[model samples]
Target chain A: MEQALYQAAILTFEELGFIFPIERPSDDECENEESTRVSVKFNGSVSGEIVLQVENTILPTIASNMLGTEEPLEDEEILQDVLGELANVICGNTLPSIAGKNEVFRLEPPRKINKLEAGEKPAAIAHLDVEESRADVLLYLN
Target chain B: MKISSRSDDILITYALGSCLGITIFDPIAKVGGLLHVMLPASIVNPAKAANNPYMFVDTGVPELFKACYKAGAKKERLVLKVAGGASLQNNEDSDQFQIGKRNFLMLRKLLWKNNVLIKAHDVGENFSRTMLLEMSTGNVILKINNETTIL
Candidate 1:
């Protein structure tokens, strides 16, 4: 599961968002930055969800690169939407590996959530680093 | 199903997931409504449909049109727009759990039977949305994660 999340996040952030992964930052490197989180739930042969949390510092760059525009959108809502899409795509890519290619699953739209609201402990987690930013993906299954 | 002739009337629905948010308006009549349908077919739960006809695509879509027409809307002038019907990644066409796609297909099928056509739509994606219908302007507005657009 961790490998799946890692691969999905790498592929999604690099290929889709055009953001490159970088060396993992030490725990103290990003201690002062704020993080934004999004969650997507899926129901099928096995019900579960993927929660993705990314540092706020790199949001503008991600949005700007994904849209390929001259200027990055500074709107908080637009940034959140971009983050939500990232989480949704990551969940969609990772689920097929764990649930099998033929299994049926319905994924709910991604929504912004806080760490406290993620509820149960995650079954697996992947922490990824990209260009001075950090992202964490958590998988919860029922 | 809610309809209004007054220009100030605005019908809004929020947080659409696998469910659908359907909007229709008639500029001449100034009547419009928004329906949030959860399922594609009423056959899945006839009892629930009987009680809340606006919960399924098959039963609810007809009622929205009927109410609009009764309130001075014409079939020819009614402009329709739909949003929400998102699916998970790599979802096959045969996946029964793809309620978003099924709901959209059922809606199109029902409307096609009536010879009605959709003007515009933002459907089929892995995202949630909030829809608003302004009765005065007959404009269907969609808000996805706070980014707003007209359909």
Candidate 2:
């Protein structure tokens, strides 16, 4: 089941115009079950976080992509939209695989979070980071 | 002249690929309106006119204008700004999802008929965007990820 989830992340990236690799979260970031965090690192400073929950994943990729520019990035609003879309796309791709076909899942529009508060309880959290030259995708299932 | 208000402000959100968000503000009347329209025109989904009025340009634009007018806005004083209509993932695998380009074209036609002009806009890209229009001051904010820009 975990491998399937990882494969889905990779497939989503390929479908979403990002190039990267997948890996496990470091020991320091491990948490309880029902929460997952996936991290993927890509070239050009394009890194993103995917926080999974029963309702939705706080996909922070849209913000990352906007900020992941070769030029010095300085916009906050665009960053938020980018992260929201990233989370939306990652969650949209992963939800169907976890839940069976019959299960109906509706994703709310992605919202921006200034910080990932400590000790915040979520069903799952996933973090993904994609780079231009290489990419890293990490899933931290709670 | 039409102006629309949603409680304290009007919240219009657009999603999916290659779709745009158009917001009109009439400062004189202190009225603001937003539309999270998907396609450029009704041709994309002519059959679902009554169901998803907000999803098409033809019906949605008129409705948005009417809503504004009802709230006490005039056509001459309206200010317009647009966002969205992005294509972060360009895939030719299907034609059903070419909503971004069609949406832009439809908006152009509708505005032309009404003699409405767009002042500022952010459109066409592979990235998705979410926009907010504040009615109090007619402030338009665009969000992408960690960055926020007032346009």
Candidate 3:
């Protein structure tokens, strides 16, 4: 399940967000620990949440790439919306792989959130390096 | 879950859509704690709950209170504030999995059972929220749509 989720995230980033991710085993290989997070809750065939946390500095690049614009995006709102949309896309793609092709799933809108709290362990957490920025995806299945 | 005692520390919790963020602060003790709960019940996944109480409302709420007490925050002197419990926008047909509504109700139930009353709260909406607790003054700020509001 974790591997499936990681692949789905990579596909979404490359195809939809125009970003590429490289797997990193440790934070020492990345720049800093600071990140921006978003989560989308899903129901139907299965229930759980998909959370994506990305390094803050790379948000502008993500937003610009997703929008296909070269101009620098100075707006925080656009960047957050892009992050939420990316989480939504990742959840939509990952669910079918986990729940099977015959199952149907309904997803909640993605929202910007704080870091994952202690004790709420993710079923699968993947760390990806995106152009020197660190991005993590956590899957919590119920 | 996080706890703070220094006046300079600011506690914050984000992305409370369908989840709940709770804070308890005691001005006298100069202590504060923040908890972010993801689900309404631990019974669905008892194994996970056993190790991580903060994942469920029923189990997490109590543990949060206990932690505050341990940090020198008196129950009576504690000011409780809550935020989050938002559903997805344009998602009205699926009432069977209204996790946000359920999460909030469970929180209220547990708090009431403990004879604890919420001083302020923001719940049930289609918007995401980020909450902050300033330990210096016990003031809680809710951030939504890039605007901050006192709660």
Candidate 4:
């Protein structure tokens, strides 16, 4: 299961074109669980966590790539939507592997979490930080 | 046009990307309805019951069926056609978000318990799709990008 999760994560990262081998998030970086955090966690027959954070500099670039428009979108809602979609893609791509061959797994909707309140439980969290990009991805098992 | 009938025509449409859409229709009375549901069920937002009842599978399916029956559609004559469980770009990250699969499974479970059988369906894969159901003829057309296919 762990191997599957790792492969899924690596495959997702490569497909999305986001360079990684990146740093995993630390306690300090994720100080507040209540703050707006673009995190993806799975629970059910198969469970895990995936988190993403975008650098301020790369935010506009990613926004442009996602929207396919040169015009800037400064709205928080738009940014959140794009990030949510990104997380959704990552989760969808990794399911078959995590759930095993012929195992069907269902996913809940991607939601923005308060970072401060995220780690209250001692779960097996795999924190992934994509560097040189405007986004961050985190994964944990709770 | 949009055939909003209780039993015969249930027409629902939506932009589906890694999301599922379930449609239920009854032909005898020509009253049917469609639901562009995003999630498997409304576990997060019970507050949305009054306004967006169709957002969850459990709530929306029953409402759609009831609405059809009210319009003189018989449950025995109903034929179901489903579409819109598509995936986004393939990636590991995408697997963590299984709204499409969850939505599909939940709908199936609900329908099974109610003794409803899905006659036809198109689900899964990494493609964005749009679905439209013609209530008058019980015809379903799926559009993925520029390609159009009847399912």
Most accurate candidate by DockQ: 4
TM-score of 4: 0.49
Better of 1 and 2 by TM-score: 1
Q: Positional deviation of A114 in candidate 4, in angstroms?
A: 42
- Write model 3 residue lDDT over B1-151, tens digit each, in one string: 9999999999998778889999999999999999999998899999999999999998998888889888888999999999998887676445447677778766765665467788999998788999999999999999999999999
In the predicted model 3, the residue pairs found to clash are: A113-B15, A114-B14
What candidate 2 gets wrong by more than 4 Å, as runs, is A1-142, B1-16, B90-97
- Give the TM-score of chain A in candidate 4: 0.62
* Residue ranges of candidate 4 with Cα displaced over 4 Å: A1-142, B1-12
lDDT of 4 by residue, B6-114 (tens): 3344365767875666665665666666667777667668889557878887788888788777777788888887776665657635466556666776676567557
Worst 10 residues of 1 chain A by lDDT: A23-32
Best by lDDT: 3
lDDT per residue as tens, model 4, A23-136: 354442544322345766666676765555555455554555445454545677877776666676776666666566676555666676655354355333334454343233
Per residue, candidate 2 scores C-alpha lDDT tens digits across B34-110 of: 77776655665677968878777778888888888888888899999988776666553344454665576557645
Show model 3 residue runs off by greater than 4 Å: A1-142
TM-score of each: 0.50, 0.46, 0.51, 0.49
Which candidate wins on TM-score?
A: 3
